[model samples]
Target: MSATPATPGTPDLPALPVLQADCSNCFALCCVALPFAKSSDFAVNKAAGTPCKNLQQDFRCGIHTRLRDKGFQGCTVFDCFGAGQQVSQVTFGGQDWRGHPGTAGAMYEVFPVMRQLHELLFYVSEALALPAAAPVHADLRRALAETTEWTAADADALTTLDVGALRGRINTLLLRASELARAKAPARKKNHRGADLMGARLAGADLRGAGFRGAYLIAADLSGADLRLADLIGADLRDTDLRGADLRDAIFLTQAQLNAARGDAKTKIPPTLARPAHWSA
Candidate 1:
């Protein structure tokens, strides 16, 4: 997460200080709770509940700076969206698994649940920030409050939460928000929702106001494309070349998605998102 704070919020909507991952305040839950397969992105297979060998006693990655070079490129793309720290510090009261083995199982189970809730918080908070989405602001606020309440629930309630149903409800409001925001763009928007455009040669395409929601753009050559006002919620951007692409004001495009793709210094992104450090300068 960027050091810069999010935009100020109103009485109905609160600023999102906890939406960004703070690994230092976490107990390395992701390294242990999540399973990974041995692939081009990972050097070895890891099962759920097993700590990564690189996780230090202080809960820091031993090769944090060299993850990509060490064939752990998948780690670089993952952002828990503050779920790690929230579960470690707030949910478990800072009781680490090593220190309290009794809570380990429950803590691990709740971490992923909390992660989904935090992700929803991130999207709703971003939607609230958009001035054009004011028409649905009331619904967004209610969704935000309900989601926030869930994050504060106990381990049992969190683990059993019907997150899919909650996501379905929130997604409706998000779609409405996207429609309102995209209408402000001065271009004929293209709807590529859920389209499989993998490895497509689309460099320098005039994609302004395009709807890429849930689109599979893996390995697509989107360099120098105009994606302003594009709705990129849930888009698979792995290995997508976004070098010099203009994504300013792109709706629901998260930092995790930007981290998953390839880019350069010339890639224009939304102000709220930080430029990936791995991107060429």
Candidate 2:
């Protein structure tokens, strides 16, 4: 979710999405820093810090439009959480590591670090916008401010950041915010925190207020599910059927997760999330 670093100081500034990945300015950092095993989702095995074969000289995916057809579907669903452009344009000053070998190592090392920070930014921003989470909004705002500022840090500073510790600190506030938001919807039927609901049939379920943190719902039938205010932090929704599902107020749902799933025009999603391009028309 990186978008050219917002151009530093533009006038008449518009609100930026919590983490928008603007690949127009990215240097294909994800193609290098991330590792992927050959699988049904990815076409080949690639080690971390190694460039992908399909990465073009200009840092764009050579087969961008045919990713799924070429067996690189995982690339289609993976989001760097804006780390790519932040690392390429901001942290490294719009320099391509290919031409400058000195910066290549640092760029790869710092990418995943920025990814973690931006992910926290995403959740913090979402929590701040929830009216039901107003009680913890100020705390979330502070966390968002702190995390947003951290994104501008240099590669060395980012590498040394205690990301796990920061995530722990922020998770406390996010947990409280989730509690306040879910309390508004009293029709919850389950608390499936870290549940393995893979392939389960949950279509049209009364899932309001369900705690789905870390749930593995791969290929689950969740069509038309009532997911309002459900805290879905870290839920794996790959290939899950979300057609007609109402997730307008579902906390922590991300574009990457949505991109990995199946849906249709009938799905009710948050304004913050765009329908994945691959979803059926």
Candidate 3:
């Protein structure tokens, strides 16, 4: 669903089926393996490895349909990138922690690791989809293959893997891929990489080809801003206003970022991403 243009060298990007989370195939790992303190996002404090009060016996959230209405807004924005099912079904052979209490500790420990790996795969897959990044496609393909292999490793192998090193290594190629794609924009671009723009008013600004990598745009007003070709890797978009913004062909923009931001029906997002259900129709 990516909108990247196709060139001679860049083949059509295949769908990344494994990158989409399938909760039915998962054991509700996120509700138990991760901890969240009571805040604007969560209703109560839950310790790591403890099953959430809202979690049901069948491994589904009791308040899933009303997560936001019940003060668990954080859950709506979090995406495991299919790591839960990978850990539960593939890594542990579909073993539920409740049935195998002895594996709970290890499962909890490996979930985060697997989540990080899956996240990287998501980014790498997006990078591969970009036609402008054809120069680095070979490297991106290798990185994707390697990351996919790691995702299939046993729990023991996964827990011991050096994720930081792998992330650092893959990030280099992603950065280059971002640069190549951004260079295609003819206009002069802004470099706001890692800037703390929280709550700033940036409505209607032209931000095409802008580099927002690792930037903090929390609660920033970006309504009607032009974000085509912007590199948004690792950017914090919590509560960012994106109404009427043009994000077609935006690089490195993830569903999690879109879910955290506020938008209206006019917001033009990448074809690959879905409009957040909370957004106004």
Candidate 4:
């Protein structure tokens, strides 16, 4: 498919270095661990833990060049944050899951979890990149280092992790990071607690770790905002623009919240979230 020119009026946000797709070290985990159905995003149906028919022995998508035309648009948007390689090389000691039947199931389980951790790292790293987040740079750096360490752990450690507990701990740091970053931006005088900010323009604004419980943020423009470790419980986020916004370790943010949001190909939702139906439209 031809590249689509970026439309004007859409916020021109800073590109995040942490979210870059690195395929060289990956083992095509998304093509194997995740399942898909024939839809606007995929050309055929696939099952969980089943390798994609188009995935080559070397772990590359055989249909990479024609993914969009073949209805695999979702694959094109997925980024594993280098977890695929980390799992394949470091965690599993360079074992090919397919070749070694003994490690296959463990590899499948670890892939998704590592993807989640790496995705979290992606957001945390992005928050660290923002100049407005200088106040929390030290904490961000610590969190980045800690998360990176987790990413490099052995397969057994990764497999046995209490993922929910790990996520909770990470969330605490992210909230503080967000608050410190948002404090640097020029904004209104009133506190934004529980504010209804649906469809609001918050591009490039520092909103680190803001308490957004039950807030209305439908279609809000959040590109380049620092949302690391923010409390987003019960927030309404329909049609929100989250490209370049760091949502790593954000507390109480759910797939349902994101499903209600109007996101696009560039919007980076949590790994727990399925692609919203409205996105590919």
The candidate 4 region of ten consecutive residues with least summed lDDT is 1-10
Q: What's each prediction's TM-score?
A: 0.94, 0.92, 0.94, 0.60
lDDT of 1 at 171: 99
Ten residues in sequence with the least summed lDDT for candidate 1? 1-10
Best by TM-score: 1
lDDT of 2 by residue, 1-281 (tens): 22122221234222333378889888898998889999999979999989999998988889999999999989888887777888888899988889998999999999898998889988877776667777776666667767877888888999899999999999999988888778888795378989999999999998998889999999999999999888889999999999999998888999898998899999989897899888887
RMSD values, in order shown: 3.7, 4.7, 3.3, 10.9
What does candidate 4's lDDT look like per residue over 1-281, in tens digits? 11221221224322222333467766677788889998766789999999999999888889888876777766765556667777777788877877787988888899888877876765565455445556655665566666667777777888887777866776666656556555643543224567979789998776655678668887799877767546575476755787666676555466546654555666555564566665643
| lDDT accuracy of residue 10 in candidate 3 | 38
Give lDDT tens digits, candidate 1, residues 227-267. Answer: 99899999999999999999988999999899999999999
Ranking by TM-score: 1, 3, 2, 4
Off by over 4 Å in 1: 1-9, 14-17
- Model 1 / residue 103 / CA error / Å: 0.7
What TM-score does candidate 1 reach?
A: 0.94
Stretches of candidate 2 off by over 4 Å are 1-18
